[model samples]
Target: MIVAVWTISAGTVMPAAADADPPFDYLKVMRAEQMWKVADGSGITVAVVDSGFKEVPGVRSESVLPGVSVMSPPINDPDKKYPAHDDVEGHGTSMTAVIVGDGTGGAPKGLAPGAKVMPVRTSLGTTMAFAAGTEGAQGIRYAADNRAKIINLSWGDYYARDKIRDAVKYAQDKGALIFTTMGNDGDANNSGNLITMIPGVLGVGALDETGEPMELSSHGPDTDLSGYGGKARIRCRENSAWCVRNGGTSYATALTSAAAALVWSAHPDWTATQVARVLIQTAGGPVDGAKRNDWVGYGVARPSKVLVDRAGEPGAPDGDPLASPAPVKAPAPSQTAAAAAAPAKAAEAGLPWQWPALGAVVAVGLGLGFMVTVKRRRG
Candidate 1:
């Protein structure tokens, strides 16, 4: 069973390009700057389960926790000398910057500057290859065990495994809110895929500056909310002056994770479910008064409204905001046929089947069409 991790890269960069000014200011649009005055996501730990993370200008070591690697060659090989927190593909660095960057050295400020990042490396090398199912499941469990308040999965695939589903349930049981991308395929009916369709995980879609869904952002009923995922600025690597303008559902997931962190930090007593509910209820509705849509889910995530204005009602502490209707139970088979019928019935009940795909793992990054270049490091 092969699973490909999806990521969008803008290309390589040189040192001098970092000096250029940013093309857009996402903080102003999302009202993150105003929200920061009330809460900066302090005391919240967001587990970035991606390629890895690097110590950059805005992302300092004090804000990062010791993390583990679940990449292939070995699921949890302690003997591997490579640093688990290092970003070989620069994808994790970008996501990390979006979550906790401190805006030092002229870098763009992150949504939750006071938050701490827990890096969980699940991919290796520049190509971001890994033992997809095993490593991903291990990574999720590790983040939950480490007491992460939020888990950010910036990568996803069409195939879903029982191990991964069980791991997601484990995290939810542990009170960790999980967020994942809705993919970049731009398909109209993107609901049948794995990862995003998994119960208890919030699927995020990308939104452009105009508050409409990005043309490339996947649309599906599973998309819980939208965020600024188009051409958003993010740090490339440690000690780099240039930030890349990349767009994908991965960025949406990261930004939403930061928003969750902010809400959780401000209301430390709130359960993961309560925080999720606030985000959904307080999201900016469309001009037409339509509460929900597949293209942008509940609408653009407006954390500032929740934090600054104290808007939204966190209904039930333990209620799942994205819970699907209960599945109908099939009648039990006769004693003799029960054993043979159980597996088939479960399969027919929407159990995920493994499918092979090229590229065992992938991470999102900036693509071409921009003048700035991004320099990447591989270990």
Candidate 2:
């Protein structure tokens, strides 16, 4: 696959060094504060597959597991380690803080403060590369084998490789939920190519404070969900007290991953499919469209709706929500009749008031299955 270089945008606004409380405007908008009171993602390990992760004072060291380097030529020199991982550019650290930072020393608190982070270092530079071409794939398999329930891939590329797809399938079969970013191509029509369009993995998009899709957020038929990606407040490098404003689908992906952790932690018995269903059913509000859109997929991720409101029912434990029947080579009358009869049943069932005008949506095989897709924008 032609993996794109994942770099933090220089356009990030660096706040003046101060001890004031970090503004968590995005958290407030998403009502994450309310959800945190119920479940802070305890016992959930989110594997952050990025450049590398930094262990900051605000983030408990125990919460961050020992990370591994998958870079070509094995860039694991101790001198090159930043907070014990080879993150020379600090992108992975920024993502780590958003997932598990404790908000000490005036830094922004992570959405899932109780969740643990597993750093799977894949590369050294801004762009990730593997000499053996299987390093990225191997890192994913490693994360799943180590008992990581959630895997966050905040980077993407244009090329799609069979090994990457197989790895994603392996992780999904192992009951691990994976999230990736849609490229930041800035196409208004939402016509951007993604590196991997696997059946089960989610492609996250970016949303601004106004509840509108970010201008730079990629969109397409594969976009499963959207999250807050505009100017998120994050802590600086490992031992630094400084804070900066970063924006991109990468941060959005991390935030979504944290939201998943919150829900999964609360309902440890639920399967990955169930957790994904709850998120989709409870996402967005009446102000947003009742039906899913191509830009924001199932609307913005609203974890509070699932954790606090306890809305939505997870249909099946093992069903593939994204699976649709392959286009028939020739439509038989019975198949056409079944398709025609679905809307009538759905209408009679009556969707909840929270999701107006969405009763027409149907699931192919499962009784109430709903497929979720995601995309991300580059920072």
Candidate 3:
């Protein structure tokens, strides 16, 4: 969550196959593209809350929505114009590129190209990430209210702020599937990340090229899941042909969001609970056959197992096995309004809470026992 200080050393890799999109080893390893033939996350909108965003060539500008900036005074790039992009420090764009980029001219192709992105720009890298928490809180709420169901929060702070927690609750109530990193301090501290303290927010780790947990990926009971962490391609500018290879839970989180988008788009009627359940069920579990481990939680995502192999069952529509009972604690009285008003608003129409319809056909004969009637409803 905390990108203490960022220096964009985006070393561009050489171009390959100008006529075709270059292959991303992570995608192939995860088999994420296997679902594109049937479902490519066409109707899902994932909100990426981070530094800023700019649509590069492989990342379609049309698919990127006109998102809002939550900066206190609002950043104005006098060099350009109003909202060419909220801000572009390269990090946010990189995360966005990993989830939805189309892989044009050797650029990175996101896992879910058919899905749209709603960028929520905040002052993440320019200042203390704690300060961005205030803006990120609002950004989360805004994204939830504006048709974004799959929300990605790639960064986090060390402390849990009440406003952000409340916003997370608000978004989850609106059926938002929130994803965040488990922090890069695994080898250093092994302490829990800010995301672990929040309920209904998934804390994701990363996996290496060998499909094992990444060495730097944080672990523990709070680690919800894992995703591909091998080198991923990213482009900083739109017109540039150069791309950089990067890896981390940030892209892992993005890939998880893209996986959710793929499942959600394929079964539009499924609730957040159903999509999440299937993802966890279909994921590649530990090699030892253990149910779950602190290192990879339930294991790395294998959405292909569901869409391609016709595996994993979507459970109850309303049941969320990962849903925490209640994590929100005391908040300053001044901030009671957002939390107080949430239930009232959440009660409004959101994710449909209906059970699957069941039907059966039966044929009945009269007392005379005359046969010759076919029951059309029979299956």
Candidate 4:
């Protein structure tokens, strides 16, 4: 399988120009090498649900399982039963690489290289945007039925869909842990995302090196955990050795899912809720020591605290950590117009499959005291 290698780069240290090298790499900041001794996600399966996926040459993994697709009208070839391993837009491929990449070309390794990926192609945007909500629901249910322990939804939409919530419940009932982005609209628009706001899902947010929330990270009551969302390295183009792009909760969600995979792999008998509880309990990024905050929710996830240090207690194997209904927040009027303009692709506040230049994200030195982000992913 041709896999694309992606290193998440977000925050102050990342240069604005696409051509400029990022000061940090994902592996180094996360200390993936050290944690590998405890768990490498062996026997874990992470289901990636996005518009579609394509493989990049050189990036390889042991298993990129062929899973079902819920996309209608077929993309590319009508005869093809599944979305081909062809990522026309980089989103799906990048999400997969960050989770299960074999680290063939360089040091920027995936957070959980030993895990398996079950790719479930759904409409995040483009030709299939019209049915994205229904198809996404189908994808979630399908992954749960197919033995995926962790489901990663890197894409999101502003509007809530009843079908989507039903799907989330179905997966949770089947013992699957779902992770979705907290969205990228940041504080300007706290509108909740369809997938993220669903009860029992981990709505991941982005955090910089200093444990501060990223300017673009969406926040609210439902935000579950934070991850290193910064400039990440990736083979954006087949020609370039590496390209760096600033990330939001989409990258954070993917890494958090990988973290769950690592934890589950180490203790195969642990239930999904137990894994979630331990992660929330062990997370320790914020300085205030708040049990849970709106900004970073349970603080930035500290898988190393669980894996290497063997920290945290997995309480109540059968009890659900998030059983109550999530408080639904109404979106600004503008958000509706923005989403209707471009289905699937716009994703409203979701991660753009194709990242705009750093200059587009913001001018350098926004005066927020953005800390320098530095780390690299590789062996």
Candidate 5:
């Protein structure tokens, strides 16, 4: 008898076993109350577009309103019930955890636990190779039309596609604050790294706990702001009952989006533009006189400060704070490397990986199921 073997390798993919209870106490952050004071994100909807999320023990459930699978299965057919969206790669699940995971035991808790998560499962890895066309864009449009206030995109590609930009614009018009990760690989200094700079998209970079940049975080003229995307890594569900040490801009983008949710939930009346403005104006920038760095953009997001002053009261709904920031100065290439030291070995322990204790309930076959097909119709 032969058993099929599937490996969720390190760095390349995240496994479900890594999802522990909310490990980091977001309350410890100085701005925790200020950010949470204004909004709990109770009624707003956030769309997570990435690998399907796994139906983990406590993470995902009826609370996560399951949206339709937009990525047509590899074999282009009109009629097939796409497997319920589950995270095959764990990346999507991790992002979801960061966005809305109920802070259980030391598990990773999202900034806004009260917000509703609209799961928009798209293809990753092999699925991308097959369904890279209009299907993904259509999925984005579908999520926007369905009423998602914030769209958190922890994934991105180098090749600029007009379809994606159009879809993003549509979502923005519908009042979605779109956030995307600046691709990992800035150390290589790829000349064509403007993937995050496309108009209307807020490109995010990675910063350590001490508020410094990470080297692997891509730097370009388009970067918007940095977040806690440091060496401290999250867990993957595969391999052992633990997670590996890794960091990237993907984490930063999700963190910032969740932070935005906290604010939006507090002031449900604020427009996407107002949310973006408050974040930029309140963010922590360079220590020196320099204003904004291409790598860190407006600098690390400082939600606590923003929420503190504007708590219980909404700021200008149409104000655009980021528009008036002094022109950003290009830091010497050497500055990025120096900033990398911020997420040193010491900061590594901050991100903890907790494996869920699956009761007999999880023993159900659905616990670790993967759906590779797409059904055209849903009951």
Candidate 6:
């Protein structure tokens, strides 16, 4: 399959215009060099717990397994099924496209093109209320119980929920690797100040082309690694045939999820902890530089490093893999200010930002701009 590649320019930060490179050459490098040749996701099932999903060409259709819908003011039809997944606001489509999209019809390619995607519509916005009472915790439980090995949570809140935490723990016990964004608020948000729990979570940070942390990529206690989450020029959902650049930790989370699939697909016997360890141990870039800043976390993740590793050979049955450790020094009090204010993509407070047209979503079969409707799919 043809995949796009993205390369980081000289420094950690690039001009906004740099996001427009065609074919995303850097992404191609990662897929060609870092990605495993084997179909590692042969038996893996990933749950993309996010907003509304429209049946699209590149994304998994039948593999887009049915789950619960918690949309508020729901879509009125309960029995209707669309031919492709519609992207109401373009957020969910971009995310899922990066995970399991086939890149057909010039659509952006996904990291794990072969894996099954179980789309669960959560809350409409960034919260866990799009679909109603089905919260993040519920999504976790559903994926775990349904034999999903990987769970991708592309949304985040400043504080962790007890219900969500417990559900994550349960998923861990059942052998699921849960990957989530560390809140896209680094260059300007208060996510770092909040207490974070690392257990049962592989918190991911955002990395740019140069393999450095984006100014807005949040960093904190639980941040394990960074991924390509930047303003990138790719296919636009408005037309789905033109180019539109986008970036954020949301994209990074999806990339990381696909990375985990690569490792897990290669070594199905490894535990979630093991898969996480390999990522950390093999992460590329400057680990020492980020040691002082909680905002950047452990720097950008380079699966290529782990892919080429001769130390812990792939498929080796040995001691605990998660035990691979890298010593770090905490940041000074002055450095903590980086966590304040708005990151690059955070919607400006009260800015008159006209939202995108909701028509494309309907065309893709999302049933948008209609009354709330929930249809129960009986087993």
lDDT per residue for candidate 6 within 194-233, as digits (tens), equals: 2124354766666554334555665655566567765553
Cα RMSD for candidates in order: 15.2, 10.7, 18.5, 12.4, 12.2, 13.5
Which has the higher lDDT value, candidate number 2 or candidate number 4? 4
Local accuracy of candidate 2 as per-residue lDDT tens digits, 27-52: 77667777888899998999987777
Clash counts for the predictions, in order = 16, 11, 2, 22, 26, 36
Any idea what lDDT model 1 has?
A: 0.66
In candidate 3, list every pair of residues with a backbone clash.
Answer: 1-155, 1-156
Return model 5's CA RMSD, one decimal: 12.2
Q: Tens digit of lDDT per residue, candidate 1, span 213-300?
A: 5656766667677787766565554424445565578788889999999998889999988788788776754333445556566655
Global lDDT of each model? 0.66, 0.63, 0.63, 0.64, 0.57, 0.52
Query: Per-residue lDDT for 221-310 in model 3, tens only?
Result: 667677766565654444244344445677788888898898888889987777777777766553234455566666566677678777
Model 5 spans > 4 angstroms off: 1-27, 58-62, 76-78, 130-133, 191-195, 231-244, 311-316, 319-321, 326-379
What is the Å distance of residue 12 in model 2 from its true position? 6.1
TM-score for each prediction? 0.77, 0.75, 0.75, 0.76, 0.74, 0.68
Write the residue-wise lDDT of candidate 4 on 1-379 in tens digits: 2111111223334434334555665565556788898899999999988755565543564458877677766655777554536555566676787788765553246899899888887655455566666777888899999989999987675443688788888888888988888776574545445455566778887865433467677666677777867776544543234456666777788889999999999999998888887787666523222355555666566677788778777767766564331211211223233224443322332322111111011111111122221111111
Best by lDDT: 1
List runs of model 2 lying over 4 Å from the truth. Answer: 1-4, 7-24, 74-84, 124-134, 187-193, 235-241, 285-290, 323-379
For residue 140, give model 6's deviation from the true position in Å. Answer: 0.8
Query: How many residue pairs in model 2 have overlapping backbones?
Result: 11
Best by the TM-score measure: 1
Error of 3 at 87 (Å): 3.1
Off by over 4 Å in 3: 1-24, 74-84, 235-242, 323-379
**Global CA lDDT of candidate 6, please?**
0.52
Compared with the true structure, what per-residue lDDT tens digits does model 5 show for residues 1-379?
2111111112543333444332333345535655565666678787877665666643647547777666565456657545436666676666776677765532355667778778776655343533533444666787899998888777665333567777877776777888888766555543213325556678787754444455566666567776766533354543122353444787888878887887777667788877776676556544344555565777666566556655222345654445655422222223333334433442342321100110000000010022221111000
